[model samples]
Each structure stands twice: as C-alpha cells, then as structure tokens.
Target: MLLSVEKITKEFPIQKGLFGTPTAYLRAVAGVSFDIEAGEVVGLVGESGCGKSTVGRCVVGLHQATDGRVLWDGKDIAKLSPEERRTLRRRFQMVFQNPFSSLNPRQKIEDVLLEPIAVHGLFRPSERAAAVQELIEQVGLSSKDLQKYPHEFSGGQRQRIGIARALACQPDLMVLDEPVSSLDVSVQASILNLLTKLNRDRKIGYLFISHDLQVVGYISTRVLVMYLGVVVEEGRVDQVLKSPRHPYTQTLLKASLGASVAVKGEQLSPAQVVPGCAFYNRCPHAESRCSNEKQDFQEVDGVWRVACWKWHKIG
Candidate 1:
C-alpha cells in the first residue's frame, strides 16, 4: 500500500461563551479507513463541510488527527517526532484548493518555489536558480514567469506554480484538495490534462478530494463517498458511479446531475436531519428499519463495499 488511513477520527471542540468552555464536539471525520495503492488516484467525494479537505490535511500532516493513524509507506506519521516529520515532508506534498490564496501575493514565483527546496536542502545555492527555472518549464510555464508575482498570472498559471512547488522535492504522493474547482471550465480542463500527464510520466499517487462527482469520475481509479464525516460507500470508479449501492451514494449521483432529478418522491431540504443513516432524511427509499438500526459497511462484490441495509431492495 502507498498510504493507509486506519480508523481515523478528527473532532473540533465547540465554544459557547467569551470565556468559552468546551460545549460539544463537532465530528468532522469519523472512523474513516481506506488504502491507496502505489501509482493510483483515489477520489474522496462529499459535500462542502463533510470533512473531505480536513481528511486531506490530516494525510499531509497539516492537522494532527484526533485519533487513528496516517501511515505513509508503512510508517505512522502521527508517531513521528517534529524533526522526523519534517524530514518525511519531502515524500508527501499537497496542492491546496484555492490557488490564489495559497500563493504569496507579495513574493515572486521564484522565491515561492525556492523556499521548499532551500528548507529541505535539496540543492546548493548556486544550482537552485537553474533548478527553479527547470521546474517552471516542467509545469508548462516560462522561465520568465519566475520573476513575476502570483497576481501577475492567470488562475491556471497560478495553479501550475502551486503544482511546481509541490513537486520541487519529488514527492511520491500528492493530496490535491479541489485543485481545479476555482477555475473556469476551459482552464479546469487544461489543468486536469496537465495533471493527468504528470501522473503518467512521474508515477505519482494522488488522494483527490472534491465534491464534483463528474470530475472525480474523470480522473480517479476508485471512488469513496463520504457523508456527515463517515464513508458510506467505496468501490472502483466505474462500479460505484454506474451502480451506487448506498442510498446516500445514489442521492449524490442524482443531485450532481440536478436537485429535482434525484430519486422520485424525495425532496431534500438543506437542513434535513437523519438520526441513523446520515442520508435517511433525504433518501427516498428510507424505511423504519433504516432509522432504527445503524448500518455497517459490508463488501458486496470483491471490489465494492457499502454501508446500507437496503442495497438489494433499493431498486
């Protein structure tokens, strides 16, 4: 396995007053487990606040997981010391969702890319300039772009810079959090193509996090559907997208196409609540048993797993 997330859980403390005492916990990621094989792209799909980005941050060591382990190449990152973790950073990198916000507006592109290389001591000072120029060209940018600030480039160009920075250390795994969601359709297509080419040439593994099912379907070898901080379904991209076992997964597919076009007799309210099935409130086929009993993930086929009671009866 390239990466393994075993029973990971991340929670945030809620504060109610000025001198805030911890009131309740907001569970962002709950008991999520999955494995990514070498040179594979695993797409994590969910709504905005369903903790897709949070999970990505934990995988990259930005946010320490509240519970469970993030294993990279068989080493548990959470168990590593500060210095050890810093050394391990070179093997894994991240491309954030918003390119404009991720870049330093005050700094030139050269400085931004140079920082990672310098910190990791990857190259000597004399060779760093040429290396940076090479990285620019690798991402399809001109050497002239090195002198310009982020604001001087278009959204797609800024993203290329972000990709170049992430690749500076020659990482094996990249956690891309909605990398192209902020760009125009044309720009998004271009960036996606660039990423696809990079992956094929470099053999880089990716943990792609996004809410757009269509986008995920386009790039992922496998798909994992998340809801209310938990995984409800997981399978090969073709299997999951074509025949979703869990009702939540079905709703997500339908809703992606159009809100009103979802399962018949189901009108999903934004504030809908489900006591058991996180998707029970919006699921058209919800039964009394769905609301009373919690479902556990069960493997249906060799490659597909689902956490739903009515998988056989959903049709």
Candidate 2:
C-alpha cells in the first residue's frame, strides 16, 4: 500500500474553559480505514462536513488523529518526529478546497512554486527557476504568469497555480480536497482532466475527496461513501453508483437523478454518539438490530463491502 488509513479517528473537544477543559467531544471522523496504491485514484464521497476534509488533513499530518494511525509506506505518520515529517514532506502533498485562501496573496507565482524546492533543498537556487518553468508548463500555464500574484489570476487559474505548487514538491501521493468544487462547471472539466493526466503521466496516487458523485464516478476506480464520519459503503465506482446497496447511497444516487428519495427514517441528534450504525437514524431500510449493534463491514460479493444489516434486502 502506498498509503493506509488504519482505523483512523479524530475528535475535537468542546472546550468549556480557557484552560481547555472539555465538556464533550465532537467526533469528526470515526474509525475510518482505506488504502491507496501507486497510480490509483480512491474517491471519498460524502455531504459537506461529513469529515471528508478532516480525513484528508489526518492523512497529510495537518491534524494528528485523536486515535488510530495514518500509515504511509508502512510507517505511521503520527509517530514521526517533526524533523522526520519535514524530511518526508515531498512524498505527500495536499490541494486545499479553496485555492484563493490556500495560496499567499503577496507571493509571486514563481516564488510560490520555487519556495518549497528552496526550503527542501530539492534544487539549488540557480536551478529553481528552470524547475518552476517546467511545472508551470506541465499545468497548462505560461511562464509569463510567473511574475503575477495569486489575486491576479481568475479562480480557475488560481487553482491551476495551486496544483502547480503541489506538483513543485514532486510528491508521490496527493490528497485533493474538492480541488474543482470551487470553479465554474465548465472549468471544472479542464481541472479534472488535468488531474487525470497528472496521475497518468506522473504515476501519483490520489485521495480524491468530493461531495459530487458525478465527478467521483468519472475519475475514481474505487469509491468509499461516508456518512457522519463512517464509511457505509465501498466498492468499485460503477458498481456502487449503479446499484448502491446502502440506503444512504441509494438516496444520494436517486437525488442526483432528480428523483426524491425521502429521508424519513427517524429524528436524529447530531451530538448523540450511537453504538449502532451512524446512518441508522437516517437509513430508510434500518432494522431493529441496527439500533443496538454497530454494523460491522461485511463482504457481499467479494468485491463490495456494506455496513448495513439489511443490505441484501434493500432494493
């Protein structure tokens, strides 16, 4: 495995005092596990605030998990020393959801691309300009834009620059959190195509996180559907989307097709942590057992996994 999320869980404490006393903990991601191999795209699909971005951050070491391990190349990043992480930084990188906020407004495009190389000693100062030019051309941007700042570019161009900045590190794995969500629908295709080309030509593995199932269906070989921090369904993109086993997955697909899948399961409290499946309260096919026992992942057809107790009975 190029990257492995080994039962990763992250929680944020609700502070009640200035000294960081916790009154309660908000579970952002709960026991999530997945793997990404070289030159593969693993798509993570969920609604907004479903802990998609949090999982991405944990993979890249932006936030240490409250529990569990993020293993990259057989090593747990949470256990790595700060210096060790810095040394291995080039091996993994991230493209944030918001391009404008991620890039520095004051820095020129050339400086933005070259600075990481300079800091990591990937290239000498004399050779940095040549590396920057090469990356710019690779991302379908001109070398002339190198003199411009982040604010000067349009939204799509800024995103191209953001991608170029990530490529500057020469990373082997990239966690792109909604890389094209912020752009125009027309422009989204070009960025998606660029990402596909990068993955093809550079042999880089990707953890592609997005709320759009259509985009995920088009780009991913495998898809993992997340709901309230837990993966309810996982399978090949075509299989899961075309014949979703989980009720939540069905609802999503139906909604996308302009059909309403009424979500009238039960009244659910966001703060309540249940022992059973997180989607149980909202699962149209939920059973009585689903209220008491947490559904464990089970193989249905050797290629797909489902966490719903009544997955076989659904549809």
Candidate 3:
C-alpha cells in the first residue's frame, strides 16, 4: 500500500476558556480506515461538516490523529525520525480548498514554488529555474506569470498555481481538498481536466475530498461515503453512486441529482458521540438495534463494505 489509514481518529478538545483545560472533545474523524495504492484515485464524499477535510488533513500530517495510525509504505508516520519524516514529506503533498488563502500575498509565484525545492534540495541552483518553469508549465501556466504575485491572477489561475506549488515536491500522492469548489463552473472544469491530466501523465495517487457527489463521480475510481466522521459506505465509484447501500449515501445521491429525500431524524452533532450507528436517527430504515447497537463494517461481495446493519433491508 502506498498509504494506509488504519482506523485513524482525530478529536479536537473543546476548552471552557482560553487558559482552561478541555471540558469536552469534538470527534472530527472517528475510526476511519482506507488504503490507497500507487496511482489509484479514491474519492471521499460527504456533506459539509462530515469530516472529509479533517480526514484529508490527517493523511497529509497537518493534523496528528488523536488515535490509531497513518501508515505510509507500511511504516507508521508518527514513529518516524525527524530526518525520515522530512524525507517522507516529499512523497505526498496537499492542495487546500481556498487557493487565495493558501498562497502568500507577499511572495511572487516563483518564490512560492521554489520554497519546496529549496527545502527538499531537489535541484541545484543552476537547475532550479528550469525546474520551476517546468512545474508551472505542467499545470498549464506560463513562465512569464512566475514574476507575478498570487492576487494578480483569477480564481482558476490561482488554483493552477496552488497545484504547481504541490507538484514542486514531485510527490507520489496528493490530498486535494475541494480544489475546485471555490471557482466558477467553467473554471472548475478546466481545473478538473488539469488534475486528470496530471494523474495520467505522472501516475500520482489521489485522495480527492469533496461534498459534491457529481464532482467525485467525475474523477474517482472508488468512493467512500462519510457521515459524521464515520465511513458509512465504500465501494467502486459506479457501485456506490449508482447503487448506494447506506440510506445516507442514497440520500446524498438523490440530493445531487435534484431529487429530494426527506431527512427522517433530528440533526446530529459530532460532539454528541453516539453509542450506535451515527446515521441511526437520520436513516429512514433505521431499526431499534441501530439506535443501541454499534454497527460493524460488513462486506457485501468482498469488494464493498458498509457500517450499517440495516443496509440489506434498505437496499
């Protein structure tokens, strides 16, 4: 496995005051497990606040998981030495949701892309300029724009720069957290195509996180549906999107397709840790067992898995 997330969980402590100790914790990601092979694209789909971004952050080392392990190449990342960690950092990169916020307003585009190369020592001074030109060109940008700051570009152009910045590391995998959500529809399509081309030419694995099912469907080979920090359903892209087993997954598909599905339960809060299935209240097919008994991940055909005991009845 290129990357393996073994039941990784991340929780944020909710403090009573600025200086006080935490009174409670908000579980942002709860025991989510998945693996990504080299060159595979796995889409993580969910509604807003469903912990999609949190999962991406955990994968890229932006957040230290409160529990469990994040393994890269069969080695636990948390256990790596400082030098080893620095070396490992070059193998994976992340592109944030907001391009403008992620880029520095003070620095020129060349400096932004050059930082990673300088840190990693990927190229000597004589070779660095050519490397930066290649990186910018690979993302469909001109070498002339390298002299400009981030704010001078349009939203789509800024996103291309963000992608170029990530590519500067020559990573094997990328964790793209809604890379195109902030752009116009026309701009979104161009970014998506650029990403597809990058994957095809470079064979970079991707963990694409998004709330939009259509966007996920367009770019992913396999998809995992998350709800309140738990993966409710997981399968091939066509299998999950066309024939979703979990009620929550079904509801998402309906919503994406402009078909309305009534939410049957009360609003759920991630802070309120449920003993049973997280989607119990919201699931129309939820049983009494779903309210009290924890749902184990059950395999359907050895390829698909769901965390709902009532999936069969719902299907």
Best by TM-score: 3
Task: Supply candidate 3's per-residue lDDT for 15.
Answer: 57
Per-candidate Cα lDDT values, in order, are 0.87, 0.88, 0.91
Better of 1 and 2 by lDDT: 2
Predicted candidate 3 versus true structure: per-residue lDDT over 1-315, tens digit per residue: 999999999999875666687888999999999999999999999878889999999998999999999998888999999999999989989999999899999999999999999999999989999999999998899999999999999999999999999999999999999998999999999999999999999999999999999999999999999999999899898888888888888899998999889777554888998999888888788778889898888997566898888778888
User: Can you write out model 2's per-residue Cα lDDT over 141-163, one digit (the tens) per residue?
Assistant: 99999999898898889899989
Residue 146's lDDT in candidate 2: 99
A best-first ranking of the candidates according to their TM-score comes to 3, 2, 1
List ranges where model 2 is wrong by over 4 Å: 17-19, 265-270
lDDT of 1 at 305: 89
Where does model 1 exceed 4 Å of error? Answer: 16-20, 263-275
Q: Model 1, 1-315: lDDT tens per residue?
A: 789999898888764556787666677888899999888999999987788888999999888899999998888997888888788889799999899899989999999999999999998899999999999999999999999999999999999999999999888899999999999999999888988988899999899999999899999999999987889999999999998888878878887887654454442322333457766766778788888677788887887989987897873
Name the weakest run of 10 consecutive residues (lDDT summed) in model 1. 265-274
Assess every candidate by TM-score: 0.93, 0.96, 0.97
Model 3, runs deviating above 4 Å: 17-19, 265-267
